[model samples]
Target: MSKLSLAELVSMVSETKSEGILRPTTSKDTGRYERTGLAEVVNMQITSGQFIGSRVPEPTYLPPHWSAHIHPEGQLYFCRQGSPRVVTEAYLYRPETLDKVTGWIKRIEKLIADQDFPVSAELELFIKLEDEDCAYYLTISAFLPSFRFRSSTCFARNCIGTMSNFFPMHGSLSRGTLDSLVCVFMHAICDQMTSRVSTFPYSKQDCEAFVSLLKNSRDHLSDGNIVCTVARLWGIICRNRYLTQYGQENSRLSRDQAVLWDPETKNRWVSTVASRISFRTSDRYLAQLDDVFVDHLVYSDQWKSMVTGCLRDWRGASHGAFLALMLHIFLLALTPCPSLAVASASLFVASLLASTLLLNRYVPLQGVTAEQAMDYLEAVQSPTFKFQFVALVFALPHTLNLWGTLVLFANCIFMLATNFGTGFAAGISTVALLAFIAFQWTTSDRFNLSLARTHDKFRAMFFRNPDASYTSEV
Candidate 1:
């Protein structure tokens, strides 16, 4: 088929309209234009020697600087201005009728022409044409862009208002379509920022690889993968913004150091990043940044497994602590103990209470998914006081569980001494001590407490400085 230009399509559409072969319809509320009789117009054009096929060429069906591709599954994806990186949502299927195709072209042209409509820096527009009678336009802005669904009928228009319903839109759109849209959005935003800024830490190849992973493996990816992907992109954007706003001299500075350099930059950066991520509170924004940086540096599966393992260990400890606390309480009620026994029981009770409270407050009791685990890990690694406090609280359940266990052991020894004789109690205590030492030696790693090795590994993972070193007493 021969390629048709935008001018030719416009001329043909206008002629058809004049001859009454196509009737234009306008919505009073949204001022959106629609037309009917596209099939008749197409037949007339072909019969009169204007075209050769049942459908016009695909090139003629799109606006200027746009091209269309059909996926293996028949979904239509539009690329803007011949750039592979700039793509619209893959929601529309291949149009069966010329009317549907031409209708899309008109809507896209009008959307781009409207100066007030928020288009991306790359001139990317997401248009969803539904049932030949309604269309929805979505554009990326500083914040979560609202979905503007305009319909020919007032009932349809009123049913889906101008509300910012992003998650709800997901229900209507397929998973693969959403994934493609997100990948395209990230690439476009990163492309725009990289072109304008000079201090991006990640190379172009890095960003491309990330987007490729999301686009290629979207079907197999879990929700955590998508979240981490977005977080990684956000980190790059934040770092670029930081370097742009506060000179590149601060590029070497860690997040803490950079924030300290200009306290005001923190607020400004938070607001800017907030707009990009659609978060409002400073705490949530900072929390998300922690997530972004951690996800940027670590593999999703590796970190997810790490956090999941830690969560499992904590749950086990919590369960053990609960059982120990109950047994200790039962023993205390049964036996008339000395002052030492009472004090030890009280200490155990207090520790267990604090641990239980923290566990219930901070940890999820149900199955901990990778996304939830990542959130916990981020809070643990966050530098902010609020997050650090919450992390400490989360750790308390495990840490205090050990303390409560020791207290319970001491109370048990006291009960043995009060009920039996000193000789019997001493023998039992000696046996218990030996068993604990043997268990530690046999099951735990011998070099687990080597701080120097730990420091070296951490530096290798996080710090790229060649001069970085760690020293410990021999």
Candidate 2:
């Protein structure tokens, strides 16, 4: 206001010009400047080189098919789309860590996209924040026209390669250590082979035995050698899976047949015939058998119980048949004038003996392993094997028991006719006939009802139709 010199006048004019110009405001001055205006000012300053060393906020990046999340403790993680449970194991704190994760995702995506056919890929990554070591696993599985292809890559601190490269650090391994490793590997293989979707039907015990034989060989071998052998076994299983898938798609085999068939297709025909004959078997027995086949490891306890119960029942029936056969033979010897009654007695006696012999020969005395049981079942159900022959052999003891009792009754009636008067014999025969008819009527009604209930249950189990009715026509 008191400027009188030329310099003072110039200073005042400069101040007025500065006051007229709009000054940029900080973010705190929201009342005067909006956020957009403030952002524009900052961008202008940065472009004009006025805001030296100032960092602009970085644009966020997220992986495709995955979502990035910040944990409560400031760790970053990524979850797969629609699958929150499937998250990255590596924690992201630095830009390098994020870059590594991104690289892995890109690599797997590229691999999946490059395949000629549809396939599945799984990736696992583990990173240590404090150490330089990292581990990653990638598994790619596909079903091809000729075979199943599976590539498992593992990168660890000590080793970097496929599953075939997994070996002890030392060239040699102790027998016990090798056995343990083999057991672990075999268990994993068995789990995959025995899974619901898997077509390989070999049991865990079978895999273990096959691997154990290789381990126990006297030839000097390294850890790598044993690992290679295990890898070969895994390849075989994959090949089998491919074959089964091909058969299911190209042939008329049922799912079970496709899964359980041998390489030559003989087992397929056998399984078909067995399925047809299975309808005639006891529903409870058939159900147990199916359960064992579905998951032998899970149903092994049930199998043991079934086998023990069947053995007990068969043994008791065999004893009864043997006694009945002896009694009938004695009766035949005692009869002087052997009529058709004697012939009936003789035939029943022969049947009883045959049933007893079959029971003794075919029935196992001790409990067998699940693998053995499955083998026995497969053998019995073979196409070359006669279903009627097995049915007759198994049913003879019980069937002959009833027939033997009737034959004895007939022999007694014939003896009465020979020794006693005709009127007395006729009266006895009439009474016996009435009793037999009543017994048969009562028992047959119950049996038919039970059979109908069993049929309904079987239908419900296999057909999944609970509302359907199964009733005898009477």
Lowest summed lDDT window (length 10), candidate 2 = 21-30
Candidate 1 residues lying further than 4 Å off, grouped into runs, are 1-104, 107-126, 130-249, 252-302, 305-309, 315-334, 338-385, 399-403, 406-474
Query: Which candidate achieves the best TM-score against the true structure?
Result: 2
Q: How would you encode candidate 1's per-residue C-alpha lDDT over 1-474 as one tens digit per residue? A: 344332333233333432123322222322222334243445434456565656665544555665665433333456554211134433333445434544655544553343233233422333344444433333222222221121221123333322221211110123544464456556655654556322334445655666666576456443433433443454344434533444454343332233323212333553454333322223343453344333223223333433455456556655776676577656767565545445555555554665556546434523454345545555565343323334344445455555556656766777778889788889999999999888776665764556557877788887566354333312
Give candidate 1's whole-model lDDT. Answer: 0.44
Q: Note each model's CA RMSD in angstroms.
A: 17.0, 29.4
Q: What's the lDDT for residue 5 in model 2?
A: 37
lDDT of 1 at 420: 93
Per-prediction tally of clashes: 0, 0
TM-score to native of every candidate shown: 0.34, 0.35
On the 0 to 100 scale, the lDDT of residue 412 in model 2 is: 79
